[model samples]
Target: MSNGKKILIVEDDSAIAEIERDYLEIDGFEVQIVDNGPAGIERGASGEFNLILLDVMLPGADGFAVCRKLRETVDVPILMVTARQEDIDKIRGLGLGADDYIVKPFSPSELVARVKANLAQYERLRNRGGAPKDGSELKVGQIAIRPQSRRVYVRGEELTLKNKEYELLLFLVEHVDMVLSKETLYERIWGYDAIGDSATVAVHINRLRDKIEENPGDPKVIQTVWGAGYRFKA
Candidate 1:
């Protein structure tokens, strides 16, 4: 039943790493483990794996540093595994190009689900990017999204958007004028509601606004709906 999809697990904790690997393997994925960030970087950059499970606390370099470095050369989904439930840590990891996160003490099934979700979503994005050059280019206000190229532009200036940030923006634009709740956006973009955290949505929204809006402080395009959520104004 193996689908030929490979995964890399970067964790110093052998027990936890084994648990993750066991679950992913049960779901038919080929899994590899690296105990530290330095070795993680070398293996991750080789682009052999379809996804990576990165631990936050490591010896050589922290997960944040590893995620940042790996993102520089690897586009594969990087899911941070952390015991820290602090919002700042989540914000930092998401900001550093990690595709998603799985907290410690999480159910092995949930870990597998998170991995599957990130992988499924990543493949969808990759397929979209493989479309012909004539694929529809979305434009709203000064924002432009070229799905075929997997690029976004604001006011004629290209922007570098991490995976989740880009997906949130595109989803909002596609549903322009509709207020999407935090839970809704989280479930839609991150692929689950079980790990629902408003900070996840807030962080990515702020990131998108920072890249797309003329003034991120008081945004005009992607506006807050007071008690509702956010709406991309067309």
Candidate 2:
């Protein structure tokens, strides 16, 4: 039932990596394991896997660098694994293009759930076909959003966006000037059944600003409404 998807596990710890591989394989996914950061980057960029499970601490590059590098070449989903609980670390990981993150000491069930969720979401995007684009295409100033193709452009230059980042930007553009609360966006894009973390929304927003805005410190298109939420001022 997994649709024969391949997953890459990049972890320095053999035991942890084996555990994840076992669980994911049991769920019908093809899995590959690589230890440390350089190998992870090599396998990740090979285009052999549909998703990646990357650990934060590694011998060569660390999870952050792996995510950053992989993002530049690949558009697949990346889930960061780490023992750190600091918001800054999580934000940094998400900012670097990780689709989601799993804190260490987590249950195998939760691990599988996260992996499945990301894969499923990614599959939906891939299989969307020629299905109606809904908003189809949207243009706000120098930024252009093509929902059907899931592509974005700035001043005629195409920009790369992660799965959630594209979805967040599309949602904001669809709302168009309406203030969307963080909670509302979390539910709308991540779904009501999702893990429900507001920080996820914030991280994606920041990432979007970094890609589209001339000055990420002070954004123009995706604006914050103070305590209210975010708005896409067309």
Candidate 3:
């Protein structure tokens, strides 16, 4: 159903840009290439493409800046590419509103896979009628979630959440007051069996707490159940 979707590639390196464009085109995407961050920002603001493949290290402005600026204008999915493989960089990119990220020197196939996965997820969210039809907001005390817009608000202030963070939060909200194990949460939200790494749950929970809880160190909205998993409290 997503065949021939338009994708914009924003990369300063001509060779890398060409490779990405060729591979994306092969996968039935209409691809366009931009060599600088400013141009990419301009084109992105125009909302011409279904998706964007953005490079972190670009001439003029960096990828993070471009992502931030574009996010102010468009909700189109952005997949950030960078040579910096550090966890901080990945977190930073996601924090800046990128839907997903891939480190540079990555296999072309892997990049394409990420692109496909993101597009599929976006389409699912778009077509699933996830948002409210009446414009009535979903609230659990100070925490509010708008499924239609895929937005979370804490204490009336909108929280900036990445794709995975939003999904995890929504799952917790749907089952508020019920304890959900890490395994269950991962399998349900990730759509596969998990290895039961509580750390994965911990990171996302922490990220959510940073936005929803008054104090992440002493969380109240999403409370951790020792020896169990987590629960959302109204």
Candidate 3 RMSD to the real structure = 3.8
Highest TM-score model number? 1
* Each model's Cα RMSD: 1.8, 2.8, 3.8
Which of the numbered candidates is closest to the native, going by highest lDDT? 1
lDDT of 2 by residue, 1-234 (tens): 565899999998999999999999899899999898999999999998989999999998999999999999988889899999898999999888888888999999999888877777777666644325475567878878776777889989999777888778777877889999888887666653456777888989888898888899988888999999999988
Show where candidate 2 strays beyond 4 Å.
Answer: 129-136, 140-142, 155-157, 191-194
Q: How much lDDT does each candidate structure score?
A: 0.87, 0.85, 0.81
Of 1 and 3, the candidate ahead on TM-score is 1
In model 1, the worst 10-residue window by lDDT is 124-133
Candidate 3 lDDT tens digits, 52-148 = 9999999999999999999898877888898985777777777777766777788888888778767776666666555468866678888788887
Write one digit per residue (lDDT tens) for candidate 1, span 90-158. 889988988888778899988888888888887766775533567878888888888888788888999
Identify the superior model by lDDT, candidate 2 or candidate 3. Answer: 2
Which residue pairs clash within candidate 2?
A: none
Which model is ahead, 1 or 2, in terms of TM-score?
1
- Scanning candidate 2 in windows of ten residues, the lowest lDDT window is 128-137
75, model 3: CA deviation in Å?
A: 0.4
